[model samples]
Target: MSSPRPLNRRHFLRTTSAAAATGYFVGSSSLTRGQESPNERPVFATIGLRNQGWSITSKSTKFADFAAFADVDANVLGENLEKLEKQTGKKADGYSDYRKVLERDDIDAVMIATPDHWHTKISVEAMLAGKDVYCEKPLTLTIDEGKLIERVVKQTGRVFQVGTMQRTESDQRFLKAIALIRDGRIGEIVKVTCGINGATGSPVIPAIDVPEGLDWDKWLGPAAKVPYRALPQMREGYGGGVPLYTNCHYAWRNWYEYSGGQMNDWGAHHVDIATWALGASDSGPNKITPVSYSLPVEYENGYPTVDDQYNSPTKFEIHANMPGDIPLVITSEGDNGILFEGTKGRFFVNRGKLTGKPVEDLESNPLPEGAVEAVYGGPVSENHTANFVAAMASREQPISDVWSHNRMLEICHLANIAIRLGRELNWDPTKREIVGDEQANAFLSRECRKGYEIDM
Candidate 1:
């Protein structure tokens, strides 16, 4: 492997103050002004090199070079290193510990694809280190982490983008849908349904020895640690009859120890759009109730009882009374898409297609020319990563800002809390809290491992 050019951490630290203050809420270009040409491309590091992180980093290579790579799993890191070096024609420094990547002076930004538990810590630290960031969605594991990220963004003024790529690459359908709703084409949407599918379920996975090239401890950063459990890794998720085999990392989502099941997984996407359309992106639901829920294991105080079974709700419909008292249903039933029911019209959309009478009649009773573009805040971007790179140059907020995402994520987190408690809870959108339930409020944040905890 070709060695990376020298990165002087001391040199970087000396200029940290001035560098962080460069560019008035602009991109990392400000940091490279005197050292490199304005036309120079920014250097980046990918912190998690697994499934989603690899996909995002692979595409992001179109906009920036991979100067460094970090992952707790040595196997994934080594494989990504070979592939990235071959594809980019540039050797990158690989580190088992992510903190080393953050210390490098050459990397101007980082694409964080770590677990939901690690998102807030890494993103916040990356921004504070004078690096821009592209964080995967379900931006935080909790509502409190969401607020933490928002504060860091404003303080660091780093170019930030969440992985809600639908905003840019929905072929104008999502934007069109939002425009139609906002334009009153959908006559004040009274109800919305988000079908995200249920959480993955399985019998208790047996704990086993730690595998080679994997650091299970670091993988559980900020999350409560548990015995290593092997999850059934089928060709695909539920619905495909699986030959049972065992894996760990990919199965992290099935456990509440690392993620909030589908609530934060697909919920991150649909909930983001659903709330954005309501113009409640900065606020949250006024009330939340678990209409009905089925789980793989019993829960107490919003946590699973069993040690090794998948814990996310299997089949559940969470009812949310949004800011305007509009009823929002998040469930696994029906088509795997978002449905907007309004007084005047109705429509549905997902990664596959966007359709409904409103979309069909757009040719006749159409929105204004720039409706979709306006939702994007400008012209349509090439893709989500392209938007991140563009915003870095233009010093503008990318399509999915951190604050807006947190508002949406807050609802999903609350949904899980209400479901786990099996009760209705009152929420104050303005205060951003549960009205009278202390138990539910506690789930807003998790107690992080001492070393992994961040100052809030």
Candidate 2:
């Protein structure tokens, strides 16, 4: 199997046409043509320097020079800045506010991995500042935020890549899956099941003093003002040393205020690939039925009655009546991956494995050469950030463009609405609204806090 060659940053920075841009990839620390020339490197700054934020920046350092790092937590910003200095042998600036990083004229782009609530605000501002964007997925907290972002991308013509890396990485497993479906190896895709795994509900966390070096209000930008909350428990994996039960840090995923829980977290990944494979990225579901779900807290009128505990659903099985009448099942049960069942055969694919009869048949009845590339729209970039830079060079949206991402995310967002309201939702994809249910329709857009609203 052939892989993409490491791209020269210079070519990507200088190229203007798609054909010239398509040949290059990203993620090479050493310049092949001119090792000492600083002009060959694109300058970058990262916002939200937590786990995923640092992850993207780490990958990007190979192709872009780090100008600064920003985070609501001073500690995170300082730590990442120090790490970047050590890794690149160059000191970069650190800022508590992302706006400082945006103000720099030398920076070429910004990578946003902030919590779900803050994504749209930062992304919109970044594009308006003439910076291309590579934002983390489950990109919007609500459907309307996605629309706002789409508008900005169109108005600015800035390259935008959502952090749905499955389209590029995962060893091209997802790309191959899409190619298989197109190859008719799966015949007519009957259903695509995305098992994004459920999150554990949190116990009541009492209000506590905000940690020193962390700007609590800035961290909660665009989100409602709330008391800082945490339990004494400490998480111990990636992004560890943080409290395991809090509406901050790693635990923020469990709250409706900051995130969409497991649905948006993992659904952003697997469901995205499923939707791509199903060829439903341009359109959305006609209805969303919450087959079953369990929320950790009680709710009143779709709002959590209590705010101290994790309020996002703990488990769910949502069925979306998608375009072409395809049934897209996003559920918490089963293995953590996508299962594509079709008229002729079936297969299952996750980060680590792609199995079942169809995948097994590939050895004897292989897909055509360049199949993955066709699904990817071009040669895949070395990584997602590389894809973003390549897109910047070509002035084209990358494989994970916002338009397709929002179409699939509409299903996930509607599923949460269905679960919260304890009823099915009839959707009109063209109108982009909930049919007839005014109350559910209200969930499509959230009101941003007064001081943190996006500027156009």
Q: Report clashes for each candidate as comma-separated counts.
A: 0, 0
Q: Candidate 2: where are CA atoms >4 Å away?
A: 1-39
**lDDT values for all models:** 0.78, 0.84
Candidate 2 yields a Cα-based lDDT of 0.84
Candidate 1 lDDT score relative to the true structure: 0.78
Residue 26, candidate 2: alpha-carbon lDDT: 26
What TM-score quantifies how close candidate 1 is to the native fold? 0.90
For 180-293, candidate 1 gives per-residue lDDT tens digits of 887887797899999999755787678888778889889887877777766445646642332243325666676667788888888889988898898888778889989999
> How displaced is residue 378 in candidate 1, in Å?
1.1
lDDT at residue 330 of model 2 (Cα atoms)? 95
